[model samples]
Target: VGSASIRPPATAGRRVPQGNSCNFGQGSRACVRLRGHALFRMAVRNAAPAVLGNALTCHVVAGCDVAAHAASGDTAGGQARGQAWKGLILRGWLRGGLPCGGQRCGSMRAGSCQGSRADVPMHGLLNARGQRRRVLVPPPLLLPLLLLTLLLPTAPPRCAAATSPTTRPEPSPQQAAAARGCSAEALLPLYARIDDDLRHWAAHGISEQLMDKALATQTTASGEKAIGVLFESGVPYVVSPLEEIDRLGHHTGLITAHLRFFEALRETFGPSIPDVEFIVGTADQPAIRLDRLENGALPYPLLRFCKSETHADVLVPDIHFQMRAFNATLLQQLDVINSVAWGEKAEELFGRFSQYKRIIHEHIPTLEVHGAGGENICHHANFELLFCDVREHFMKWAHGVRSSGAPVDVARQPRIKMIDHARYKYLLHLDGQTCSSRLEQLLVMNSVVFKEESGYHAFYHHLLKPGEHYVPVWKEGPEDVLEALKWARAHDDEARAMARRAQRFTQNYLHPDALACYWFTLLGRLAQLQRFEPGRGRRAYPVVLMASEYLGSNAGKAYVQKHGLSRMELPRAKRVEQRRA
Candidate 1:
């Protein structure tokens, strides 16, 4: 028998009737709950595994910067596509909940599970029904659709608009010469970070033995274990099915983003695009241990999405694939008021860093904060008081949790556009699952980023200086962030200058055109390092596949179909240009 609370989501036109409403807090709009039915939830998860992974992430399709939430039906299948995505995420939450308060997992009932309210972690809220039946769930985490909302699309840096930060010490002639200039060609913009990743992989060039092992480990799908793709004459022949980001993958797994990156590469290089077979690493965590390459457990190079410099994985343009260029106004009219922050409130990560919220909350009068998602804090340690509710703490999450219902939610902080972030004097950058994917966007904005220490780094992060680009927030504890906040408040000009300097750097180096160019340079460098002939090995297909056939998810299908990318056409060939080694 269905529980009294188990009910359907609100219809488009009707109000959520009475008790069915997900009452978050006073004055807050209710959170939409999933249809409380086990069979239906199971069916939804099975029907679209691809959409399931990204639904909890909202518009975070690698670089998807929603133009006013894409209300128009034109982008990637309109409203229907979005609703399907919502269902997938809601189901995922129901099926994949991790009970953090007590080790006892409880099934969903009355729009909640049998767990302590405080134990809800950061992702969800659980009710304390001590006598309720406890049934174990899988993986144990309700991945609220967002934290670093949409891997932010960064625009081509505008050199004309940049002013050297006034606080920066004068640069010597040598330093000036080394600085990236706007005149730098977009296709071959070189940075030491990109160079470092390539150089590391090139050193371990796929030996004949290594190639054989890599091929053997390959699964049939685009990213089950690994994927195989061959680019020839600027046209790509996907040798395996592609997977969108699912339970296991991050931004790199977005098939649409991957396709866009390849399409851009093809447009730039044409027939000159190198004929290389590669495995794109889609996970936030690097797959191949660079240190353990000798073990041969995993044999080849992985072009990774995350900055894998420390882990020995090859780095590539990550969010750049999904995102367009950042196009917000060059510099904002600064308010220089309270700082804002958004974080991925997963219980394990958030609870570990909950003190950050506690500190920010304690200092609420001076600090106004907002962001999305949360994880329950307690882990069998307490029956209550986990991640029950912290919305009173402003600007705290990355992306808000998505459910099946209308767009409006009064209970939480409203969405803050990346461009609007410039209005504040400061923005806090925190690590979610890895490095914050939106870091590039935050740096491009005029506001100073109080960046916390994180394990992951993007390839471009190497170009940043802690003092020059952003003020550092120590990971030692939450007290450090408090001190950093005080420092920013005390020395305002330096903060502004630091923001200016960081913006200038992006304008010079992170331009969108520079990105397409960077790919060209990166691929050319990889071509130079490739010792073997492309078609000479057993890996070459007798008849290459149309890249569109590789779409393996509903989202991928919608993306390719929405755009006219389903055609089987080769790019016009171009003369191979000589690249600087």
Candidate 2:
């Protein structure tokens, strides 16, 4: 085998770090050496070179044949598993050479030998013509995380213990408001669109007619799954997206997070947030005012928030995505609850899945093979023939591995375990693709964030102070991260102190009560922009139930029942009047 393999690969001569192990091969013979413990057994069949794109090269592994691995015996699920593994291998999911010796011939250090294909290409990802090709791998594949998590019979106990009921009592709005500063001044910029919409709608005067016009426009804006939620007396109905979620969904968990966000606002602020029908979409987009396309005046209100799982930070904080990182990997198995706060629980989870704990128990005996090095896929990094961006990043800085390999991009990028992020002294937060969701999650990880400067920001960006909450990094080029890395290594204490400050800011200001208060204040401002009364709309759920259609199951009903919020009294919107800004 040559250079094509998983990113952050088990390099040749790199001993399987003892402690935890990953069984990655399919064979009766063991090629594993984790402090000399027999861990993974894989029998690779040698076949023809796998074809990548026209220019990218693929070399044949000595004994690694996709056809044989897919066709037969010990590697179960015959055709299905075979095709799956074959797809993984061919797509460059697992490639590279192994560290041959020891387990195969009782010699601790043996040279590379042929396990299968006699014509194994030891040089590079070269072709028949010997032309070198450069191929940048896609982000990491998600199948490995899914495959590994399924191996756990049940998740370790959630931050909340089910029996004793780790759920905490809800803090009163008055109590929370009294303890925290309730200034809406810092947050007004977060809703600049609301002001723009209001100025536009004021000229039109009729909210009813304005909505009728807006709804017609929305209908044609990609007729996918868009449900509008008319908030009558603080009770939420359902909403719309632009031409994303792809336009119906982006991930069901995010939709639930936003719906529940409205529910939490209703819970904390009562009906003071006026009756308004909002086409609240959960996407990495800006608030939509259809009129922006027309006269730039106030039209029907709509907001498309990035809606990270942590946006639960804007409201409940209990329906957290980070607790189990449920949204990223682990499927829809969100049957998790944190008895403690997510920030605190994160520390525990990090240590629990610590890359240090994977102890692989091997059950197969090694078969003595002739002439083959029987390397354990680690030796494949030698050929500097092809270029890899991540490999280059690693070679240059020699620190800062990608922290969220499991849930985020796992392929082209090298990754560490989900919680291993805490173990990293410094974490780089780049606004990937758009304003990244990584910033929110990283600040809470107790590591210094090398936050790259970006124009995009969330509603809560006002709270972060550069040099206080994070160490700023210039995002001008690829080496921006490299620059930040050198600075942190030079000034260690200052970076650590900033991380402490960020942790304090998150824990003190990001409480469920404080976040709801932020939403509560934002809603009042949101309604001020509405020119017409928002009372006329279809009812979805009573303000008292708190159960949304998005809740999806009886477990939500039970959660509502247990929390004492289900039947909490609601302040009628018809009564309270808000002052015009």
Candidate 3:
């Protein structure tokens, strides 16, 4: 039989129909309103699983029906039955059976089984009717099951305890220290190896011997010892019997002796020594013996050599006819010093140093000369005094000029005018304006030289007149050195300022620390390559050093081809002359 209930009565009565409108008033006629049957149908569908689940629960717990019934409905019998059914459904869901609503049961059932169902008494659904047929569901079961339905494991709430910061494992102090030590150990070996190689090179004859000698003569014990070995053997002293004997012959024997010494040093030192460099003059042709070597064989401390000229060329107009000629000559002298000191090319080294000195002489007055006589001296003597003073002034000027990027042309006229007025007057009218600090110094230095010519005014005037040849007089004095020092001290503040500016400029563009970092990074890359691939080593290649102006010149290309080196592999060549300096 279907369960039925009576509908509640309405207060108002129905009215009679008038024209087209008819009103059915409340309570006027017996109205039979159907209670919502759809809800009952859904409940029946949901309850079927619960009923089946209850039957299974009855098998497990026969007396728990009273509690289930009470929780499911208000009536004692029904509540007891419903409660028992609810308990059964929960148990079934826990065991992976279908839900009470026939949905697929999930992991939520595990929590449901572990909830507070045991606390609720089974007899609580009994009423005054004394009906014991209904099931009484434990209150805990109903509430926890309802929660389980909402809080199922399909999307379980994140466990705060699991994610809490306190649960994370902290690193042990010993482990952290070990890690740091490992990093340091890895870095230390690399740096140590590099330092060891450099030291080996220094201990052998790789460093400049003449430089070593100069340091030995001028510096402390440590400095002297720092390059002592370099000076002892590999270097050929300029005044040696070999130099006299060889004269115009090939210096290959000298070079080969040095190479053999280097080879012996490397063999004695084992793998630490990298290679030996032999710098020679471009005109010098060394003996070549390619057939003596085997393929893939390491040549005992491989030989790397370069050719550079170190002496001043009289034929080069740029050096001979340019401004600051005397200053240029002095610089040429320094090149001789460096070559003797550093085993540099004679002509090339001299040329660059001369150029540098000329620049400096044109800008600063570090050297000066004074005559024994006053303004009343003969014209020739006065001219000599004037020429010496001008030469001194320009020498100092050139130092300052060379330190900057100024052109070396501006100081020529004043240089020539002060030395011999007649030969170089044509240069005076050309480009009167000076644009650089170096140029300004050149002019100021020239002014000082002009002042020194006061005694030689008549001779200079006569020489300046058209078609008269000017004969330069040369003089030497002790006070000139003091005068040069005074001039240097006077411009010391400006020099310091320029030096600071240059330092700042270098920091921005050519910082040594940044360069070190780059080198270290490159080293790391090389190390990585070596580690990843064994047996593959750095290739032996020839390097060509050419002047910047000659880099793209045909002669330079020809030289590259002659050496059997690829143009592509060529590093941007710095001036070999500059390197020597």
Better of 2 and 3 by lDDT: 2
Cα TM-score of candidate 1: 0.50
Best by lDDT: 1
Q: Find the candidate with the highest TM-score and give its number.
A: 1
TM-score of each: 0.50, 0.43, 0.15
| Residue 503 of model 3, lDDT score | 24
Instruction: Please identify which of the two predictions, 2 or 3, would achieve the higher TM-score against the true structure.
Output: 2
How far does residue 231 in candidate 3 sit from its true spot (Å)?
A: 21
Error of 1 at 135 (Å): 79
lDDT of each: 0.42, 0.38, 0.23
Model 1 alpha-carbon drift over 4 Å, by segment: 1-189, 201-204, 218-226, 241-253, 294-299, 324-412, 536-538, 541-543, 548-557, 561-581
Summarize candidate 1's per-residue lDDT along 216-293 as a digit string, tens digits.
464334235445566754566655544433433333334445665575455445445566666665555555545444
Ten contiguous residues minimizing lDDT sum, candidate 1? 69-78
Please list the residue runs of candidate 3 whose C-alpha ends up more than 4 Å from where it truly belongs after superposition: 1-257, 260-269, 272-490, 494-581
Q: Which digits, one per residue and each the tens of the lDDT, describe model 2 over residues 459-576?
A: 5665688889987753343345545656666776777688778866655554444445555554555565556666544422222222254453454443444443343322221212
